[model samples]
Structures are given as structure tokens and as C-alpha cells.
Target: MAKLYFRFGAMGSAKTLNLLAVAHNYRQQRKKVLLIKPQIDLRFGANAITSRAGLTCDADLLVSEKSYFTLKGNDLISHDSLKKDQKNEIVLDNKLDYSCFLVDEAQFLTKELVEALYEITILCNIPVIAYGLKTDFRNFLFEGSKRLLELSDTIEEIKTTCFYCEKKATHNIRLIGEKPVFTGETVDIGADEKYRPCCKMCLHKLKSR
Candidate 1:
């Protein structure tokens, strides 16, 4: 049976790049793979996933919370060639007939979407893989990440060193201008300029003094 996999990381941990690599692996084997990204991430325009290392490809599907539910047997999708048009044409409904579902920036997903994803593997026989930030800037659980933690068959953390201390970082620090701030919505679209990865010790120490 296919499994639901959640791979999470802090800022600058190459989550998207890893997700893309997985896609490449599947395609190289002649297996159908779908690349999905939440519509909320527009840092590189709509329907595109661009890694900081310059690896990029157009997303097969740009989805929101409702993509999991938009399918209700309306799809006439056949064969396993996995064309990009097939993805955009099929409405996301409870009936998951696809080979695989992959989501990037999954931290933006809603709780309902995550639950539906859990069902995709168990009840619908579709494998689901999601990659995203594990925690927000304020060290709180993103609704999507929280749900994934509870429902995922396997949870993996992608590790990287802290931006300032060179320690193993587990947190994403948000910067407004030149200074760090602990405030804001969970999803902010900024690359390199607005976020930093920090270790737990540095996080606590920075917040304290």
C-alpha cells in the first residue's frame, strides 16, 4: 500500500528542492508523478516551483484547500502518461484516482485538506507526499503541518545549519527590515531577505536577550 509521507524543515532547508528531486526520480523510472504547489506561494509567479539553487519546473497543479475535495468522479483521465493538462482538467474530489499526489508548501494546507490527504492513501489507494515548513516563525504549528503530524504514516525532518550560529537549526526567524521580529501571519512570501534558520538554543537566547 502507498503511504502518506510528510517531509518538513525550517527556512533554507531545501524542502522544495527535495520535493522536485523526488519528482525527478519518479519520472526517471517511467512512473507517473504529480507536482503540486499551494497557490499561496507566488514568490516565483503562479504554477511554478523554483528552488534557491536554480532548480525549477512548472507545477503540474496549483492547489488550495479544496483540491482534495474537488474530485467527484468528474475526471475522464485515462492512461498513466501524467500530462500537465490532465492534472488541471481533473477536479479534486473525494474520489482520488490518480497514481500520486505531491504537495509543496504544504504548511499552507488546511486541516480538512490534510485529513482528506490521509484518506487518499488508505481509502483511495493513492500515495501522498507533502513537503513544507514544520513550524512558523513564532514557533507555532501551522494548521496543515499540525494535521500532517497527526496523520502522516511517516514524518521526516530535513536538516540544515543555523544561519548565524552554524548549529543545527530547527526554527525559522522572520525579519522585517534589519531586525528580527516574532510577529506576522504564518505565510509570508520572501526569499533570503525575510527569513533565517536558527537553532533552538539560539532561538531562546535571542528572544531572551
Candidate 2:
């Protein structure tokens, strides 16, 4: 049976790179892979799924909080066709014959969307791999990550070392002008300069200062 897989890591753990590599492997084997990303992640571009190492690919599907999915025969429909009100939803007429579905920045996804992806894996018999940070800078579980942890058939952690030490990093520290700050909006989108991966001790040390 196909499984819903959640691969999470702290900031700078190369989650996006891993996702891109998986997609490449699938395509190299003559299999189709669908790339998906949350519409909120515009760090690279509106539709670009970019890795920090410089590799990039256009996302086939850009999902938002208002987006939902339904299987219509062998195809997947993004919005409800019967519902006359399609206000903020993205409508897509895409076939669901892909061998795999890969999602980047999965933490930004809404809980409802995560549930829909989980359902797709079972109903469509297609494996879904979602890569993202397990927790926010505030050490809180993201809505999507929380649901994935609960529903995914396989949960894996992509490991990386702490920025200040050789120990493994388990948390993210939000930064502004090289100084760590704990108080801010939950979803401040920025790359390397804005966040640092820290271990428990280093995180606590930084917080105490």
C-alpha cells in the first residue's frame, strides 16, 4: 500500500534539497512526479520550488488554506465543481496519474490540506512525501506538521548540526540583524540570515541572554 510520509527537520536541514532529489530520482526512472508547495512560500518565487543549494523547479500545484482536493475519475480536482462560490480557492484540472506527490515547505500547509493529501495517498494509491520544518521558531508545532505527525504512515527526521556547536540541531532561532529574537509573528518568511538552527542547550543559552 502507498503511504503518507512526513520528513521534517529544523531550519537549514536541507529539506527542500532532499525533496528535489527525490523528485529527480522518480523522474529519472521514467516515472511522473508532481511537485506541490504552499502558496504562502514566496521566498524563491511565486511558483518556484527552490533549494538553498541553487537547484530549482516550478511547482505543479500551489495550494492555499482555502484549497481542497477531490478525485474525479482518474483526475484530481482542486475546487468543488458543484459549489458556485469559488471565491478564494484555486481551480486546477490536473490528471492524477503521477507516480508520486512531493510537497515542499509542508509546514505552511493548512490542517485541512494536509488531511486531503493524506486521503489522496490512500484513495489514489499514490505515495505522498512531504518535507518541512516540524516546528516554528517559537518551538510550536505548525498546523500542517502537527496533522502530518498524527496521520502520516511514516515520519522521518532529516538531521543537521547546531550552528554554534557540533551537536544535532533540534530547534530554530529567529534572527534579526545577527541577533536572536524570540518574539514576532509566527510566520515571518526569511532565509539563512533570518534563522539559525540550534541545539537545545544553545537555544536555551541564547534565550537566557
Best by TM-score: 2
lDDT per residue as tens, model 2, 1-209: 78999999998999999999999999999999999999999998899999889999999988887677755532233444435454344433364678999999999988878877887887778899999999999999999999999999999999999999999999999999999998888898899999989999999999898
The 10 consecutive residues of candidate 1 with the worst lDDT sum are 74-83
Q: Which stretches of candidate 2 lie over 4 Å from their true place?
A: 73-94
Residue-wise C-alpha lDDT for candidate 1, range 132-181, written one tens digit per residue: 88889998999999999999999999999999897899999898786888
TM-score of each: 0.85, 0.92
Error of 2 at 97 (Å): 1.2
